[model samples]
Target: MPPSHTPVQYTTRIHDYPLHYTEAGSGEILLLIHGSLCDYRYWRWQIPALSQHYRVVAPSLRGFWPAALRSADDSFSIAQHIRDMSAFARRLGEGRPVHVLGHSRGAQIALELACGAPQEVRSLILADPGFRIAGEAPGAPLHTTVAKLLERGEVEPALAEFVDAVNGAGTWRQMVSWFKTMVTDNAYTLLSQIREINLDVDLDRARRLQCPVLLVGGAHSPARYGSRLDRLEQAVGQARRITIPAASHGMNLANPKAFNQGVLNFLAGLRADEARPPAGIP
Candidate 1:
């Protein structure tokens, strides 16, 4: 079993909202971004391990969990998330470019930040990034089903259907009680995402990023997700790929060992690259 983390909690005011976050360890900064309908705790399996080598900071995106919600007009967009993450990284890193790892929708936000504010991010690890690709309307059926179920006031069943769609059938039964509570707490946000159009990312910009990027995917994830990652890998000039076996869209929770080791290895390579001298000088 993977070691669990008891994160130190903190909140910082950003753009008229208080952003709640969890932190552990101490060293250079590493930001972990979670997907929709979840908070920083989604990265619980990762914090204790990664924090040993780097200060891991995972913040709940605005309008989720402890973070107070604002009007949709004032919050909830990829651009907004990018701004929040950039500001969070800057304040936490004290002007140093911090390392970032994002999963699912959070991955889309991370890519946007790396492209829009490259100077704020040192390197990136994107696991099953949730972005529309090749004009594919991924998750539409599930989203519609969940939205209808939520409309009919069947919150639990709605959540179950949604969870099963992402994590595989029967996963909801295996999920911890608190995990279910977490999802239920964010039920509204999950419903809103069905119609949200703010997370669309620009691959043209992503391809231009000069920093090292590791694109991760789960071996058993839906084909659409794998296909999108493949397209993204091909788009990014400095990208590498890794697939965690026996895993699905929710790879971090499904296979933390492979996910954690993959990240550690990527960070190690980045360090090695920095240690290498100028090519002509050697």
Candidate 2:
């Protein structure tokens, strides 16, 4: 049997809201941020695997489950998430920088954090980020379709449609009841996201990131997603790219082995570089 995915749960007040997170292992901090409609549970497969070599901290973003907001407000914006994550990371690090990993919408927040506070983040791993690049918007027809379904009081089908769009056909049905419940609990946040505008990161700011970056995507994902990764790679000079074969937008959930190995290998290489003496120093 695979190692248990349970993590030690904790909560800390970040700004105006309480952020719930799951932590495991001990070493340099590795903060994992989940995407929209997802909480800390999304990293179930990764937590146990990566915790062996690093302190893995996966936090449920503001307005996500276990603390879902009753009112929809600006508090759920990407800007707000960045602030919360920055505070969360700082608290975890105790003055040291952390390795940040984000998926989908969470990736956008991670980018903002790296750009706004380079000192707080040691590195970045963005998987199937859902955002704009170089003034181009990535199409999300499923978002609209799901919104319509939800408006008609069809929550289950809406959730199923959204999952299938990101993962693959019939993927939603395979998910456990707990996962579906969490998604349904946080489904309201999707409306806020759809109405928001001018949320995409500025490449000009992204170009200023000095930390090592590893861009991850699924080989079977839509072309727009791949293009966004390409643009992001160009913005963060020297950034590495890794594509998990036979996977879609939900690479972390669908192909956790490749996703985990890719991240672990990148981190190991970073550690190696840090230990190596500068050329000509000897």
How big is the positional error of residue 43 in model 2, measured in Å on the Cα after superposition?
0.5
Candidate 2: residue 129 lDDT (0-100): 86
Tens-place lDDT per residue, model 1, 108-209, is 888888888899999998999877754666445677778778778788998899888776788888888768977887776765575554336667888799
Alpha-carbon runs more than 4 Å astray in model 2: 1-6, 137-144, 168-170, 174-178
> RMSD in angstroms, all models?
2.4, 2.2
Cα lDDT tens digits for candidate 2, 191-275: 6676543356678988888999999999998777888898888778969999998788888777889989999999999999999
Relative to the true structure, candidate 1 has a C-alpha RMSD (angstroms) of 2.4
Global local distance difference test of model 2: 0.84
- Candidate maximizing lDDT: 2
Candidate 2, clashing residue pairs? Answer: none
Please give the range of 10 consecutive residues that has the lowest summed lDDT in model 1: 66-75
Task: Assess each prediction's global lDDT (C-alpha) against the native.
Answer: 0.82, 0.84
Worst 10 residues of 2 by lDDT: 1-10
Q: Give the poorly placed runs of model 1, Cα more than 4 Å off.
A: 1-6, 68-74, 137-139, 197-199
Clashes of each: 0, 0
